[model samples]
Target: MTITTPNNSFNATLQDLIEYPANGINSTVLLKDNNSQYSLFCLAAGTNIDEHTSTRNAVITVIEGSGNLNLEGKDIALTPGVFIFMPANAPHAVQAKENLAFTLALSEHLPAKKGVSQKTIDIVKSTAPVIKQHGKTITTRMYEIMFDTHPEVKSQFDMAAQANGTQHAKLATAVYSYATHIDDLESLKAMVDKIAHRHVATHVLPEQYPIVGECLLKAIKDVLGDAATEEVMTAWAEAYQALAGVFINREQQIYQNAS
Candidate 1:
């Protein structure tokens, strides 16, 4: 994974940390320490890390690829934009079944809430499509609605999309897998931070979040039809808050952890 920070600020860019080569099972960085008290990582495709435990609670986010995470004997397949948390000393391992990029945040010093457990809630399961045959049509409609209604954000995405190249397609596939398991709140937080950090570097405004959120909802409704209930929207809103909270916490932590 390539790391670029604009003017050496706290913002960091990760260009396909965990990646798969053409016809080669993907693999990338598993870990790195940047002297910021938090270690980062990018795991490559088809590479597997043996079961191990860390002294620091580690948060992992899939920024661009796909993989499977084995925590305490359970397997969780991960796609782009998915987040997973392993509390300190929790035994876990990761494997890239396909090309995948991942980020990990591990801090040696962090305030603790006593009695909290590190065991993660595993949510990767196979399910039938929400709609039998109309999934793509609905998804497209929602995407169109989102871009058409929010022209400014559309411009931002359009640029990214244009420059996305092959990387963009891979990222989209990964994100599809992630949206399936968005119920994990901590994981959501990690995904949010990863996105915010990336977008902030690209000059995306904070105000665009609601617009993005609304677009996502429209997509959900369009795809799920009547299945996209009010509760679903509420859940998504809470997830967004969880994601935003991580950013706020990180900004504060940067100041407090400054040299």
Candidate 2:
């Protein structure tokens, strides 16, 4: 198969580029860049690609084919027009029940800003004790401010939880945990994953992060008063953005896979 590097935009009919081998798969690299790649793949009937994992995220769009895609141990039927997304490192395999052709796109994962600075982590961690003590108060005030200013977001939350104070308690716990784990994020992986999934279920949009962050910072200042120094606020702001970036990226992947 030929691989070409284009210095300018190029277009072609994907179907015309397919080449099916009698007993194996054939592939052509259509385009490649610093962080992404696109390829076309064709497999003869009965051919298969063994289960494997990719370092980068990938999407497969069936152009003209019938197959079965085994993604993360779940089988999904593949036919013309079917699209599948696989997150980075998800185990997957493909078998061509009939002659199959598809386009594969791969993308590198862009992690949020190489993590918060050491000073930011130290500052945030130092405030963990105070955050733990006043966490619920700050989160409750945050929700009030947010609902008063952006009432549209109220629909995404559970009013019952809010009324009973469970929502505030949960946020407080999460914030305190985050502050304590600021330097060792891996310890908080389960919490992060759970929250990311919950965010997706609630259809949280990326744009709303800034609103929540602003309200949270203001609430902290209001509740902590003179204790919330400029340096502390700055560190928390940076830390919050870093945490938001992680959730945004994870939710985006979940959304793509659902689509």
Deviation in angstroms for 212 in model 2? 0.4
1-259 per-residue lDDT for model 2 (tens digits): 4465556678898888888999888888898754577899999999988876664689999999899999999999989999999986577899999999999998854566569999999999999999999999999999999999889999999999999999899899999999999888899989988998999999996557777988999999999999899999999989998887788788878876876
For candidate 1, write residues 194-247 as lDDT tens digits.
655666555553334445556656776667666666755555444433343445
Best by TM-score: 2
Error of 1 at 3 (Å): 34
TM-score for candidate 1, please give it: 0.37
Error of 2 at 1 (Å): 42
Model 2 lowest lDDT segment of ten: 1-10
lDDT of 2: 0.88
lDDT of 2 at 18: 82
lDDT of each: 0.52, 0.88
Cα-based RMSD of the predictions, in order? 20.6, 16.7
